[model samples]
Target: MKLPHDWFHADSEDKEMYGKELNLEMLSGHFLFSKNIEVYAHRNDATDDILCRHIDAEDLYTVVHLTWSMRPEIDNKHPTVEFHGSYDEFLQYNSKFFN
Candidate 1:
């Protein structure tokens, strides 16, 4: 998925610094506002970025530990979430990163 302009992300600076492919081993996500939301994932066979696996939303700890690869925001209220970026760059970045 294509991320917005304000998405907050922490890429492997080492990899990017050396022009090497980043092996995204995992990602961590923490629930901030809602009880919990289930998000569906489709296995991808082709990509320009490194991705080992995809995790479900219920497994919030995975995102928290940064063990699941990229975490792009995908929610019904995504527009609202993206707009919430006004709160701060970090929140906006997180919203774009995790949603």
Candidate 2:
């Protein structure tokens, strides 16, 4: 049988740094209007950036690096959609910080 993906065990103790248990509070606090975003990894507790996937999008595997706007506008909603690409591409993009 095929093994499960690492993300499946994201809540496990071994997955702390790279993967984490889905923090509903964090999602709600950071992304107030985003109902379609499923956050997979929260890199640092100090920052608002998170690795997530668009639940309603066609490509579920597409990893997204999102930075939520600290200040929301009265009429316009804006959050910096920094990067949208494959998981490997996401890793490569963030490799500098890890390495």
Candidate 3:
């Protein structure tokens, strides 16, 4: 999926310093499929940790935290709850949190 051109502009500096592109192959190995929505786990500049991007049927996006490894337990501090709206919303929310 293609992201907006300005999507990472705000965090470009942090991205340049610490962000790693999402590993689609590795992410696929970690998540189980569900019918309603698709989840993507990718590396981001959140303390150099991972983030999850969720896409619904209409293509709207929601982002949340994901487990660092392929383990059953998730980090409760971060929670599995999704927030933000679109890719742009995800970036905005993260820009504040990360900064």
- Please, what are the lDDT tens digits per residue for candidate 3 over residues 14-48? 43332222232123323322323333333334432
Between candidates 2 and 3, the one scoring higher on TM-score is 2
User: Mind sharing the TM-score for model 3?
Assistant: 0.39
Clashing pairs in 3: none
Query: Using lDDT as the measure, what is the rank order of every candidate, best first?
Result: 2, 3, 1
Alpha-carbon runs more than 4 Å astray in model 1 = 13-54, 58-99
The parts of candidate 2 lying over 4 Å away from their true place are 1-35, 56-71, 74-77
| Per-residue lDDT of candidate 1, residues 1-99 (tens digit) | 333333223355622521221222211332323323222121122222221112233223111222222433343321111111122343344455445
- lDDT, candidate 3, at 57: 38
- The lDDT, on a scale of 0 to 1, for candidate 2 is 0.42
* Per-model RMSD to reference: 14.2, 7.8, 8.0
lDDT of each: 0.27, 0.42, 0.40
Candidate 3 regions exceeding 4 Å error are 1-41, 45-55, 74-79
Error of 3 at 86 (Å): 2.0
- Give the per-residue Cα lDDT of candidate 3 at 3: 38
Against the true structure, whose lDDT is highest? 2
Candidates sorted on TM-score, descending: 2, 3, 1
